[model samples]
Target: MPTISRQGTDFIYQQVTRFISGQISSGVLQPGDRLPSLRRLSDRLSISVPTVRQAYVELERQGRVESRPQSGFYVRARARNALMKPAPCRDCKPAPVRCRSLIDRVYEGIHRPGVLPFGIANPSMAKPAAKGLNRAMKRVMARAEERSIGYAPSDGEPSLRRQIAYRYLELGGAVEPEEVIITNGGQEALSLALMAVAREGDVIAVETPTYHGALELIESLGMLALEIETCPEEGLMLSSLRSAIDRHDIKVCLFASALNNPLGSATPDEHRQELVALLEAHDIPLIEDDVYGDLRFDGTRPSPARFYSEKGLVLTVGSFSKTVAPGYRVGWLLPGRYEERVRTLKRALSCSCGLLQQMTLTEYLASGEYDRHIRALRPVLEQNAERMTGLIGRHFPGETKVSRPKGGSVLWLELPRKVDGGHLFGQALDENISICPGMLYSPSRRYRNFIRLSFGHPWSDRIEAGLETLGQLVSGH
Candidate 1:
C-alpha cells in the first residue's frame, strides 16, 4: 500500500505514476496483473479519481500498462531478458567482410512465398501506411499531374528536400534544404556518404554486430572493416573506439548509433555528442546510419549525431522506408562538408530517385498525415515488440538472452553457446521461417551463437507457431 504525499514538489499524478512504476519495478505487481481500479486507488491513496486516471493514462502511453475495453488497466507482460553484457570482440581488427554468400541465402529465404518473415527489419510493414500513402500518391498525381512523372532534379525535388530539412529543425538540429540529397533509399544514401568520404581499402570502424548492408557496402568498395565493441544497451563503446583509433589507420567510422540494427540499442544524445566530438577530434568522418531514427518505441526520436559535429564530419542518413513505405524508397542524406561530392556521386550513380515517390512523400508530410501515421505506428511496433519478447521468454531456453529494444522492430537473441546460428537459420528456413543469422552481421564472424528475429510484421498465430518451433529447435526437442 503506497501512499502519496502532498508536500512533494512533483504533481500528484506524477507521484502516483512513480509509485506504480516502483511497484512494477519491484515485481510487487507482476505482468498481466490487474491494476487497482481508479476509484479504488484514489480512495486508497486519498487522492482524487482524476489523478489516478491520469497516472494510468501516462503508464499506458509509456507502454507499461494497457486498458481493456470497459475494464481497468492491467500490467503489460514486460519481462525483459535484456542482454546484460556486451559481446566480446577480442583482438578486434580490420578485415574484409566475408558473409555475402550467406547473406544472399538469407535474403532468398526472405522473399520465398509463404515463409514467416522473421529475417527482415522493415518496421513500417508491421502497420503500413498503405491507405494513407496511396491517398497521398493520388493527391500528388492529381496536383502535380504530368510533373509528378517527370525527372526530379539530380539533387532531389526541392519540396521533398525542404520537408526533410524541416524535420531536422523539429529535432533541434539545423539542416539546409540544399544539404539534403534524396537517394533511392537508405542503402544508396549510405553508399553515397561512404563514397564521398572514403575510397577503396580505407579502414572503416563499425560496431561489432553491425548492419549487414553496411558491411556489404564496405566489402563491395574493397574497404576493410574494424570491429568496435558495442554495448547491448548504450551502443558504441567509446573506450574501444578510442583504442581502435589509436591502433589502426582508420579513415572512417560508420555507425548506426541512433538505433543499431539487431541489438536495437539507442545511444543517448550525450553519448552521440561525445562520439561526434571524439571522431571529429581524430579528423575521422562518421557516416551516421540513422535509417531507423524515427521508429523509437517511445515515440521520442533521438537527435541525429550530426547535431553535435563541430568539424562538419558527421554525415547523417535518414529514410522513410522503415517508417512509411519500404517500396517508396525515399531517403535523404545530410552530407555536411561532403555535400558537393555526394551530389556529384548521386548524379553519376542513379541520376535521381523516383519522382513520384518524392512528390507523394512531400504531400504526405504537408498534409500532416505523415506525423499522424508515425504516432499510430509507434504503438503498434511497441506492442509487437512486447508480445514477441514475452513469447520468446516463454518458449526459448532459460539461458537464452534477448535484446530489449528501446524502439525498432527486431529482437537480437543469444542462444546457448553450443547452438550454431547459421545451422539454426538453415533449419528455420526449411520450416518456412526466415531468420537473420548473426554471422551476416559481422565482418569477423562473431555472434556465432546469436540470431536476430523481426517482430516487424503484424502479429499472428503463424508467428507464434514459428517462435515455438524455433524454441523447440534450440532446445533440441
Candidate 2:
C-alpha cells in the first residue's frame, strides 16, 4: 500500500480519507476487505496511529467503512458500488406545465403524521436548533407588545432586514437592508417574484426536474415553462438555457442559488457569473431560491446569483423554514431592481409576514448564535445524508443511480428501468413510508423511474426499515 505524505494542502486525516476512498472507488479494496491496522498504517506511512484512527472514524461516518467489534475496519459492501450522477436533460421548447395528479397525493403523504418522512425537503428537527428557536419564540411571546400582535411593514421589520443583510455580507454579497422584503415563506417570495416579472401566458425558464413547487407556481400563474437541461453536479446548463432563450421569449428565469431541490446541485461561482451574464444579456430577470444554501455539507456557504449580477437582476428568495424555524414561516427576498414591485405585491396579497414570528427570528439572529447553530447543524445533516446514501446503495437495485451532493439533506435517486417511481410511491406509503415521486419535480412525466428521499428526519430503525421496504418494492420482491 502507498503511504500518506503531507504533499498537498489537505490535512493528514483528509489525505488518508481520500486515499482510502480512492482505493474503494477503484475496486482495489473489495467489499468486506479489512483496512490495514492503525499501527501498521502508522508505521507504513511514518505517521501516528491516532491519525489513522481518525481517518477510520471519518470513513465510518461517511458510511464507506465500518468498524466491527474486536475486528479491524472493513469496507462496506454497498460503498464499493459506484453511484452515477443524474443525466443531463435535453433542450426543449416552452410548453404549458402538465402537473402529475400524484403531486397532491405525494404532498398529502408528506404532511400526514405517523408516516415515515422521506418526502419533504426540510431540516433535521433532531438538532438542538429547534430548542433554540422555541426559546426565542417564547421570549418574544413573553414580552408581547401591541406591535408584535399587529401587522408588520409590508417590506418587513427593519431590524430583521438588517440582520439578513448582514448575513448576506458574510457570503460576500453586498445587500442593503432596504433591498430586502420579508415574506411568509420562500414559496411566497418566489410567487411574488414570478408575479412581479411575468404576466399571464408569459414564458418562464426553469431547470428540468426542479422543485415541484416551482412548476406548480408556474402553472398556477398561467405561464408556460421552458425546461432547461440541468446537470446533477453543476445545476442549470447555460448552453441549454441560452438555447431555450433563443427559441423562446423566456420572461424570467427561476433557479436555485445553491443546493437545488431534487438533485441538490450547487451551481459553482463561475457558472453563476455566466448565468447572470446570460440573463442580463437577454434583459430577463432571475428569481433564485436559496433556502438550501445555508445547509451545505461544507462549512463555507456559496454566493447567491445576486453576487455576480452588476445590473441587479437577480431576485433571491430564502427562508428560515428550512434552516431555523419552519412554523415561524419567516422568509425574505432581495428583489434587486424589482424591490418596489415585490413590496407592492406583498401589500396586495397579504398585509405582511407575521409580526411575532419576525420578532422571534430577529432576536435569534441578533443573539449571534444563528451561525453557531448552523455550523453544528450542517454535520448532522451531512452524516444523515451519508447514512441514507449508503442505505440506498446497499438496498436499492444495482442499476440505481444516486446523487452524492456536496450539500443539502435530500438525495435524488434514479432506479432501474423496471421500477416505476409513482407505483413505488404508492407502495411505500402503504408501508407507512413517504417518498417523493420523480414526476412531481418536472412539468412533464420524464423522471417516472426517479425519486427523491429526505434525510431531514433523524436516522433510526424506522427509517432503516422504511428504506428496506422501498428496496424490496423496487426489486418487486
Candidate 3:
C-alpha cells in the first residue's frame, strides 16, 4: 500500500487506490477472489473513507472489478487484462429466465414509468438536484483533470475507508480504518464477505423470510441454506440459530439485523447480544447487511450485532447507495476476523476505482452536509410510509398484514390466504402499478400471498391513485 497523507481526508483514498491498482496490473494479485473490507484496508493503509471511496469509484469506472447486486466488489471474472476492460452490468445474467413466475413478472414490470412500482427497493430523487450530487460530480471531473489518469488501488482509498470507519464509530461501533474495505456497493461487499467466510455446498444459515439477494447469493455459490426462523418483531431468532448450529455444520449466518428486507424489522439490542454470544459459541461468523441502517425513519438508530461480538466474526456490510448517493456506486464493509480474506477477495475482484472519485467523495462526506440532507429526507420517508400503509389498510379488501419497521423505507405486506400475490403482480402491472410479490422473496413458494411495497419515493397524487388501483387489482375488482 502507498503511504497516505493523514492531513486531508480525501488524500488517503488517493494513496490507497494508487497502491491497489498498481498491485493489480503488475500481476501481484489474481482474479476470482475477494478484497479486504473497507475497515481493514483503511486501518492498514491509514487513510480516510472518502479517499478510499474515490479509489474504488475509479477502479469501478475503469472496469477492473464488478459489483454483484447484493454482493461486494470482487476481482474481475478474469484478472490481469480484465481490469482494463468493462465489468459486467447489474442485469448481466449468463442465462435469462423469463419465467411464468408471477413475482418475477411483477418485479420485471415494476420499473415501467406509468406503473406504481412496489418492486423497486431504492429511494427516488423527486428532482435530480435534491442532494447536490451534481456538484460532487463536477468536483470529481476537476480532480481527474488535475491528476494524471492512472490506475487506482485494488484496496481502494485508505482515507475513504477511514471515513467509513469514522462513520461507523459515530454510529456506535468500535471500528478502525484497517477493518474497512471500500466496495463498489453494499451488495458487492456482502457477496464478497460471504464468499470469504463460506464456500460451495456449505450449510450457511439465513434468517427465514430473508432478503432474496442473500438467498440468491447463497444459492449461486451452491450452498445449502439452513433457515433460521426469525421473529416478526425482533428479527433473527437467536435460539433457533443455536439449534440449527448444533444440528448442522453451519459456516456462516447471513442476516439483515437492522431494517431487514421485506419485513422492515430491526433486531433488538438484547437479541443482538444473545445472537453474538450464540454465534461465538458455535464459532460461526455473521454476515450482517446494514445498508438501510442509516434511513431510520423511526429515529431509533438500530445497533448492529457486530458491536456485541468481539470475536471478529460479525462482518458488517453497508452502503451509501440507499440514502446519500446511489449513482456513485460507493459501499463498504467492516469484516472483523475475516479482514485478510475480504481484502484478498477485493483485490482479486478487479481492484478499486480512481484517485479522483475517491478524493471527491472525501470532500462530499467530510463536508458536513450529509447529516442535514439525511435529516431532511427522514421525515419525508416516514410520512410516505405512513400514507402507503394507511392506503393499504383502507383500500385493500383482503386481510392484508403489514410490517411496521423501526427503520428502512420499504414495507412488507402479507395478503390474505390463497390470494396469490404472484397473480396480483400481473394484474397490478395492468393497472399501471408494480408490486414485489412474495414468491420472489424465498427459495420456496412459501410467502405467495406476500408482497413488498417501497414507500421511499416521493409521494404524490399519482402514488395515491396507484395504490387505489393496486387495491382494486388485489381484490379482483
Candidate 4:
C-alpha cells in the first residue's frame, strides 16, 4: 500500500485515485479484478472510508471501473485489447476508387428492416432529440406559416448561419456568418469543398481506413484517392502524410482530423496546427471533416483546423446529422478562401436545403435547447460505448483488437486473420444482424479481416444477444 501524504497540496482522494490508476497501468490490477472494499482499503491505507469511496466513485466516473449492486467495485474490461499499431498503408499510391460493390452491399444490410443495425454510424439516434426538434419545428411553422415551407436561400437561412458562426466564435475561432454556407448535409458540404478545390483526375489524399462515403464521392467525380497511413489512436500520421505529399501530385487532402469516423481518433490541436502549416506551405488545400467534432466523451470541442490556417487553405465541414437530426439534412461549410466557388456549386447541385428543417434547427440553436440536448446526449453515448466495449472484450476472440473511441458511437474491430469481414457480414445478415465490413472503409480493401460496429442505437437485450451471436460466429469461423 502506498502511503498518503497529509501535508501535500493534493487531496487524499486524488492521491488514492492516482495510486489505483498506477496499479491498473502496471497490470497490478487486471480488468474484471475486484478492487479492495472501501472499508478494507481505508483500513490498510490509514484513511477514512469516505475518502476511499470518493476515489472509487471518481474511477467509476472515468469509466475505469464499475460498481455492482451487491458487489464491490471492479475494473471494467472495456479495452484490454486496444489497437496500438497503425494500420498499414503499404502501396500508398493514387488509385481510382473501386470498393463500390462492397459499399452497396453494406448499405443494403444497414437499411434492412428488422435487422439489428451495427453497420451505420448514426450517433444522434442513441438519444434522439425528437421532442425538442418537433417543438422547434412547430414554433417555426406557427411563426413563419407558409414561409416555413418555402425554399431557403442557396446559402441557407440567415439565422442558422449566424448561430453556426456564434458556435465557432465560442470555440475561439473567428467565423463570420457570411463565411458559413449551409448545405444538404455534411456529404454535400464535402462534395462542394472537393469541387471547390480540385477537379476530375485530381489526386486527393485520404486516410487509409477512411470513410466509405468519401471514397464514393471521389469515384463519382472521377478522382483518384491516395492512401495516407492513419494511426488508430491519434488519426492521420503527419510523417506518412509528408511522405505521400512528397511522392504524389496530391491536389487536395480530405481528413477527419478532429474525430475520425471508424477509429474515433482525435488529432491533437498542436498536430493539427503543424498539419495546417505543412499543407499551407505547399499551397495544397485541406478539407477537414468535422461532423463528429462535438461528440467527444470529454465534452472538449476541438478548435477547427481552419482556426490554425494563416493562408486560408483549410476548409471545414460540420453537420447536425451526427449530433441532432440526421433526417433533417442540415449541414454547413466554412469554405475559407473558396466561399464563392462553394456557393456556386451548392446552387448548381441542390440549390437550397429544406426551409422547414433549417428554420427548426435555427429555432433549436437560438432557444438554448440544442446545447441542453447535447449535454444530455453525450453521457448516454459514452455509457453505450463503455457497455459495448466491455461486451466485445468479454465475447470476442483473445486475439481481437478494438479501437477504444474517445467519442462517437462505433467500434472498429480487428478480428483473427482467418476471419473474413465480408463473409462475416453476410453471415450476420443471415441472422438479421447488420454489420459493416471493413472493406467498405478503404479504397484498397486493406481491412479484409476487420469490421466496424455501431453502438449508436439504444442499448437493449436484443443488442446484447446480437453481439453474443456475432461473437459466436467469429469464433466458429
Best by TM-score: 4
**Any residue pairs clashing in model 1, and if so which?**
none
- Which segments of candidate 1 are over 4 A away from where they belong? 1-80
RMSD of 2: 6.4
| TM-score of candidate 4 on Cα atoms, chains taken together | 0.88
Determine which window of 10 residues in candidate 2 has minimal summed lDDT. Answer: 79-88
**Per-residue lDDT over 1-477 for candidate 1, one digit per residue giving the tens place of the 0 to 100 score:** 666678878999998899999998776875546789999999988889999999999999888898866656877765456686788786987899887899899989999999999999989998988998899899888888889888999999999999999998998888889889999999999999999988999999999789999999999999999999888888889989988888999999999998999789988889899989898888999999999988886677899999899999999998999999889888888899998899889999999989999999999999999999888787778778767876787789988888888788999999989999999999999999999999888998888999999989988899889999999999982
Candidate 3 off by > 4 Å: 1-107, 124-131, 143-150, 354-357
Candidate order by TM-score, decreasing, is 4, 1, 2, 3
Per lDDT, the best of the predicted structures is: 4
State the C-alpha lDDT per candidate: 0.89, 0.82, 0.69, 0.90
Candidate 4: regions farther than 4 A off: 1-50, 53-75
TM-score to true structure, per model: 0.88, 0.85, 0.75, 0.88
> Can you write out model 4's per-residue Cα lDDT over 169-282, one digit (the tens) per residue?
999978999899999999999999999999999999998788999999999999999988888888889999998888889999999989988998988889999999999999
Q: Compared with the true structure, what per-residue lDDT tens digits does model 3 show for residues 1-477?
A: 666666776655566667767776664643323456666776777766565667777777776654434334544422121101111112211121122344345556965777666678776352122446557657667756745256656777777777777876887777888777888888788888988988777877766667777766766777776666666666776666666666678888888877778777778878888888888987889888889887776556778778888788899888877876666677888878888888888988858755655665666778766666776676566656656765776577646677765556787777667688777877777777777777666555467787788887777788878888887777872
Clash count list over all predictions:
0, 0, 80, 0
How many angstroms is residue 468 displaced in model 3 relative to the true structure, after the best TM-score fit?
Answer: 0.7
